[model samples]
Target: MNEPQAIAGVPLRWVGPLRIGGNVATAEVEVPLATYETPLWPSVGRGAKISMLVERGIVATLVDERMTRSVLVTAGDAQTAYLAALEVDARLDELREVVRACGRFTELIGFRHEVTGNLLFLRFEFSTGDASGHNMATLAADALLTRILETIPGISYGSISGNYCTDKKATAINGILGRGKNVVTEILVPREVVRDVLHTSARAIAELNVRKNLIGTLLAGGIRSANAHYANMLLGFYLATGQDAANIIEGSQGVTVAEDRDGDLYFSCTLPNLIVGTVGNGKGLDFVEENLRRLGCREAREPGENARRLAVVAAATVLCGELSLLAAQTNPGELMRAHVQLERKNATTKLGG
Candidate 1:
């Protein structure tokens, strides 16, 4: 409802204390959503134009009334940090599968990592160039930590445990194990139907792909998800489970777009930076638990339910984004403006009421 107040630079929120390789540090930071919009960009092909249409559309619809807090995770050694990265990577894989299954897609590039032992605290980052994979990354991180505790012997099964921990939608928790300081992951989508105009109408293009039966055909044959979808889905999942949402922007990266000689579309997504945990600040809400239930992770149980659910959600998001983009690529401005106007009308109705 209210415009976000702008500062010269994005401010970082203090998530909590993290231990990295024998050194304990506090993690603090938040990435600003890039709002740069330019009109002079060229379109995907000749006789077209691209702008901030897609970015605007998705952000407008998905990020309503939600905000993410900062996070910090500490690990005892580099091995722990590396393990954390592996955990994030595992989650990203789940997301990618979902995206591809939703349509025909692949991961052209992907990455995962973590930062530990900073006086400034744990630094977390993630991004998904495809649709949105916040949930995938977050849930993965939580599951990984919890799994470690379960598998490891005499490892305190508590705060540092990545168990099913969801605070309010606005809080964060620090999962500490063997002094793990910070953890992060990132992924991106490289394959898009309309590359040039992705920034403008990404969601539209994905939707179009489905509407035009482009994705349906791909799905019928068989579909695979991309790393980018996984990255974004993980981030979104985390945000929903009381993790920071904005961190997802950097945690996910490396998106690629592919098309055959006939212009048949294929895409790939990847994310290597995911820093999230499930044992610190925001695991104390009733509604948050209900939301997790919707995702199928009622508690930290055997088989890592939270992590698995995150993977499925990532796949769903990728499918949705792919379909959305396909439809937009075919219809262009028509679909793009439809939702924009709908949003405006809703605002007007609310104002008038």
Candidate 2:
């Protein structure tokens, strides 16, 4: 057993419970330590989870490493935070639609509100079970910010652009694209569904397929390289909208798993870092309207956040379909054999076997 190693260097720490792959790993570390110098107001006794990825022999690989960034927002009291949280929730609803179109609709968890100066930083958690939901979530966050700005006259807003969005287009926008805090969107899906049909190598899962053909000339790397395939969600989304294609990087990641349940098989896809806004950017692109229509959503009036929700759903839909195809391929004969056996047994029993 690998004993718990100290988490490098950190002073303030929080010890609590964590669930990994349903396995309880009780370890003590820091409780929302100051990754940045900004003031924080996280609650006590709330649920939290820490995820790490390993490749080759290295124990801690960030897939992509990111430094801490901070922003300032202010909310007068808990009621203000709660109200901002509701606006954030409505924006997330838009994100859900996007992922749903691409994969199966599961559930979403995580919601927080932070205050900096006079600005209010709203955050939420989204789960894109099968498909990548990065672009979907990022856009949703942006839309939420826009909504807040429209409603609240006195409050200004900014975002913490570290792991989520730091690309050229994102830079053009104000602050960053995430929820202006240490935001994380974790995905969970069953693994039994996507084993033999698709490549499971770690390198392959990270590649972004959607951007390979469109960005500049054909790039040397393929979508299956190091969390690159996540770009597909962004590519499809950007083409539909007029978004700066670069911001997609701030909110993109992909993960896959295979599971065996008794005699059955299942598969899952997890996408985190979906950064988006509700009312601002990318609501008027011609193709965006078309894509929204395909997903049974209206493109008119504040479609930014709605677009984000739909994008996540679409990614989930894609994932679910991919898993279905793989599952069918692995067990081609089982469906037929099971039916035939059942019929024969019924016939024999009818004759008083």
Best by lDDT: 2
Stretches > 4 Å off in candidate 2: 1-69, 72-228, 276-279, 299-305, 317-353
For residues 53-85, could you state the per-residue lDDT of candidate 1 as single tens digits?
222111101111111112334456556655655
What is the model-wide C-alpha lDDT for candidate 1?
A: 0.32
Global fold similarity of model 2 (TM-score) = 0.32
TM-score of each: 0.34, 0.32
Most accurate candidate by TM-score? 1
**Worst 10 contiguous positions by lDDT, candidate 1:** 58-67
lDDT digits (tens) for residues 140-252 of candidate 2: 44544555567654445545332223333323122332321112122232232222323232122222222322231226532322232345444444434334455455434
